[model samples]
Target: MNQVIRNTALSAAISLSLLGTARADDAKDIDTVVVTANRSAVPADEVLASVTVIERSDIEASQAPDLLSLLARQAGMDLVRTGGPGQTNTLFLRGGIASHTLVLIDGIRVNSANQGNFDFAHLPLSQIERIEIVRGPRAALWGSDAIGGVIHIFTRDPSAGYIEARAGSYGLGGLNAGFGTAHVAIGAGFETQRGFSATNPAAGPGSYDPDNDGYTNRNLSLRVHGDVGTQHVALTGLITDADVEFDIGETAAINRELGIVLWGEINDRWSHSITLGHNSEDLNTPDFDSHFGSERSTLDWVNTFTLNADNTLNLGANWAHETGFSESSTEVSFDEGRRNLAVFASWRGHFGTQTFELSARRDDNSQFDGATTGNAAWGLDVNDSLRVRASWGQGFRAPNFNELYYPGFFGFFAGNPDLRPERSISQEIGVDWLATLSQRVSVSLYRTRVRDLIAFTSPTFGAENVNRAAIDGAELDYHFEHGAFRLDGNATWQDARNALTDLPLLRRPDRKLSLSGSYRFSNDAALGLDASAYSSRPDIGGDLPGYARFDLRGSLPLTAGWTLEARIENVFDREYQLLEGYNTPGRSGVVNLRWNGK
Candidate 1:
């Protein structure tokens, strides 16, 4: 282990040095990035923190259905999507828990206050303009769940008009049509996907068919933008619903979800956004002869102000209410509410030959009885290509409603109302290098000490909820691009140990690596390949071996407005389990025909 750590550190240092020289040669003049990071538009390359961007072109080339699959393909990211379409999804970064990652749409938080996570499967990819990912603790800037990092999604604006329709395997069909002309624009999209169950037939009652489950989903969105004198105005609304049949062993469970979001923005330097949404998850288990349902509603508001060219500030507040019910007629129903308020500030200035940035934020959570948390980060550009950054932040997560009110089977289970919010103090230091005009590299070492880490203890009649543990890790990423060919990869090594028992954290792997490359065959055609490998993880009761998988993508421009795209996933058909009892799909191919109406 020591040798591995040493090797990683040395490699990181060398990569950073090479990247520095490369960035100087590849530097280009670009516009400022308008993001929720600081609630304003700022020069992308000027930001003092580590941020990764995925443009629309990257998404089209990847040919993934949802954000989870696309993000999973990125470096230093771990994603779990249960079964197929319409299932729940979660992401883990830099050894942080799944719930520690915060997700934002336009500038509003999409994470469920009650469930403590976002359902990535429900987010449509067709409407996204771009995705920006910031790694490491960002609680000081975003607050609360930003212990791991932040993922902000920007939807396409109505600057141009477009319409497209596509159909594929497994009852899959889609239609996306929208129009926009500078001041006025509107559009809508719909999609339907079929699901399948995968269970071994030889396993008797515990076994089921892997190709019988099905799912259907639909979505509608409208957006408008206009300029009013010196101020800009924007409005967006979305509604989505899904019905799915998920197979569990010999039984089939039906699930449905409905969600809505409305957001507005005004002016370039000042804006406010709000979101009101609801979701319900219903499940049926034939073996237990029981039916379960959980429902939740959320309201969020965020405001931003650019104090000046060197200063920016942001304020956010949100409230949520949730309830659960069971068909067994037990008093398992409860009403829960959560409120959060936060303030943050960031500044950039130059000191001699070096550019510097300072940022800080404070957050208060009502669920924890007004507990206050804060974080701060600073960065220094040693030169045009050499930059160093350090950050320290505190993050917290309130116990879920199920952990506090759910009753166990046979009336033997009970909820814990005395549980405290899990908290963590994280610190990281990293360097960035622009190795060449078409190459970049970065490395970071981080440590997070968490207190009251929430986890389920002994599960005899019911599981016991408790807090305990710490996680530390390092990450490295490198990218090289030259005209029609590009090479990129990232590796992450981590150690998560239980503070109390001195045992390794369950389900957390020690090593993860991913690499991808793409080549353009002609002005109208391109081919891409991706590969990922994960080390074995110790299971408390099961044996899970290491696994690796590969994927291939190809695209050909057929006409001025139409294109042909194909993707082959699970190229090697390596069967692996990211989570117990959940198996991923095998080799599959998808061909899509896309048209962009100018």
Candidate 2:
């Protein structure tokens, strides 16, 4: 306990030190707008939630190879990869399970119904315009699978035409091209890499693989929008096709999302929007002779009323139809479908220097009992430079198709038809201090309790809701910008444990820290450094030792509309593993040549 406390204190000190030492000037409130927090556009500072926004500038500055690598540097996030690129990847938010975090692409749900989770391995950075991460429960606004929070990805909306090509170590190569006009934008990217062996013989003979693994991916994104009279309409589509080679065999997967959205002002105080979306995934594994797929169709209608400058009301309804199918060599495993309908509402009021919000939701599922969730939040503008907020919310997640009706696996594992949904409650309080226009600091503390967690245990190896979990955590963030230099840092400390056993949850570290800085030269060139650290974590084989990594990146102007960009990853080349038997990338370098056109 002493060690844990000391480590937490050390992490906090590192983060707070940035704020105290910052010397910046002429910093202005950016007033970034976010939608995932409330299902409607709200300024980030005004929303009473722990949110992080990764914009295009941040993405290019880091030059991360994949979405998994980029998200790992954020606060309250942990990631596990079974192998190299294109392998199984899982994301845990706020110490919650992979399925607890809901992912969205342009307001369309993309999680597979079979596993109730989205794989981050195949998602490339080329197609993303921005990412909004909201930590903590959000079931009051979204229907289910939001115990941890939400991650919403917006597809590329290029403002200018650009083409880029890349080459690096490990036989990596990629090409990306994009263009935009008044009403439409399109982007395409292709990448391939020769990766190292995925498994280590130390784990077991079955886990040993001497041959090299490889990954290939092709992706496309499109967006079109226009204003007709007083109504605005937009259509977005994204698709990714990937093939991965492993020791035994190979797997081919495809992910696709499409959505159409329309919004219009109904009156002086009323506005409404309607979104129709579809998401689907297909995976095929020739080695196991298995094929699995899932699809979801959804519709959302939201109405907003501006009662006054300081008060508002939001009402929304959601409907979704989902299906999952699986088959093996000789026979079909399971083919099932389900439907859900939900209605939600929220009220916000501001009185003096205090802000209050209350929200509630009811969801009816075809296969399970109806669930109701709610949230209440309060905020105080203590002064011009200080603000405080607190929030409490309830969340729940239904059993996935695999956990409800899948047949036994090799006579060892089976799905239980009679399983209950997991439920949770979370509370958090936060403070934000605008020390100066160019310097800001924020602190948040949160706790969550989850019940009826599903697990496969004991003799039968069947799924059962016989477990519980508890998580307590704190987060600190600092940002500073002075002239041509900028700095950002964050620290996270969490105690996520199994309630019954009192053991730390698997694959989730107790402490995490990240520090990043960047500088721009007068010639439009830039340089950046990113550093991240994590504590050891418990897993099936044993405890995985902690490790730290650093990456150096820079961009240089070559000529008009031409630039050179490069990154050196794993500067120290520290050997480490994200999973018990998996291998991580060593020191490597990548360089890119990009051309832009007006």
Candidate 3:
């Protein structure tokens, strides 16, 4: 693992140096982006953090069905799943525990209060406008569950008209359409996938047939936006339904979710947004003689006020209710509720040649014993090409209902009403270099020390959640574009160990790397290639072998408004497993046809 990390780092350094020299002669002019990484929009090059932005065009070109699959290919990140589709998928950032990472949809927390993690598989790709990933400690800005990093998903607000229909392998079919006028806009999309039974635990030898076990998922969404006199108002609603069955066993599950969001600009300096959502999951397993279900409803509101051109203030509050009933033979019921409130403010401005940012937040929760959390961050741009950032914060998570009350083999588990929230403190520093107009490179180093980390231990029928570990890592990213071709690469090396045992964390890889290049043959044709590698993963009780995979994609414009797209994944047919007892799909091909009304 040490050798691999050293080699990759050396290679990245060499590449960056070479690209810097070549960039001076053939550089193209492009606009820099301003991101809200510190609760305010600042020049991307001036931020002392490592960040990656995936634009809408990049998402469309990837041809992925969901955000999980798309982000899995990114460097410094690892994705694990138990099966081909509809299975639980987890994301690991910078070698942190899956639960340590935070996911946000339009600034609304998406992590489940009961599950302890977010299911990235359920997020629809059609509704996404862009994604901004900050690959390091961001707890100072986001508060809790951000000990590792933060991934913010932004949904699309139609600015143009488009419609598309596609069908392919695995009984997959989809319809995506949207329209936007000067004053108003509306859009909707849907997708279905017939999943196979490759990972059925109860399946016999021949029962592993990929076509036998079938699963289907459906999603629908609607978005509307218009101006209310001098104020801009927008509303978005989405509904998703998924059903899956295992062919070898009489087990099935169904999930449904509905979400609505409202946001608007109340004048130039004031704005507010509110979101309401509900989700339900029902499962039936004759093999285990268990039938269970759960439902959750959430309401969140945020208000933003510009105290001036250089200072901003934000206030947010949320309430959630979770209730469910389960039955095996006799009937048993359960009910749980949680509420959270947070207030935060930030300031950003320039003092001569130096730019600075500062932010602080406080959170209060009502569940598993009420606790208050706070966070703060500060950053400075020393010069046009150098910046420094540091942050410290506290974050916590409450115990879930299942962990507190559930029936076990030996006895009935007891709920611990006195449980405490898990907490962590994090710090990071980074440097950004724009060697030339066409070449940019960034490196960031971060470390996080956690206390009362959540975990399940033996010796009792009840839960024992504890945290005792530290995670440290470094991230390197480079981007170069010249003429009709572009190249981008990113790599990360992380070390997460038990504070007492000094043992590596389970399921977290020590190294990750990704590289991609794209070239435009002409005004109507383009080709792209991507590759990724992972190392230092621990198997059930030992180390697992590492592997790499490659993918190729191309596009051809056929006519004025028509185009054809093709993609080949796992071109070498590499055999690897991201989840134990589950097999990944072999080589596959997909072709799509698209049209632009504009």
Q: State the lDDT of candidate 3 residue by residue for 332-409, as single tens digits.
A: 634555565555555555565555555566666666444455544556666565566665555555565555555455
- Taking all chains together, the TM-score of candidate 3 against the true structure is 0.84
Superposed by TM-score, candidate 3 places the C-alpha of residue 50 at a distance from the truth, in angstroms, of 2.9
Question: In order, what is each prediction's RMSD in angstroms?
Answer: 8.6, 8.2, 8.8
TM-score of 2: 0.94
Candidate 1 per-residue lDDT, tens place, 397-422, comes to: 66666666656555555456666777
Candidate 2's residue-wise lDDT over 101-174, tens digit each?
Answer: 98888777877899999988887888776788999899998878999999887776654777879999888999
In model 2, the runs with Cα more than 4 Å from the true position are: 1-31
TM-score per model over all chains? 0.82, 0.94, 0.84
Clashes of 2: 1
Q: What is the lDDT of every predicted structure here?
A: 0.62, 0.83, 0.63
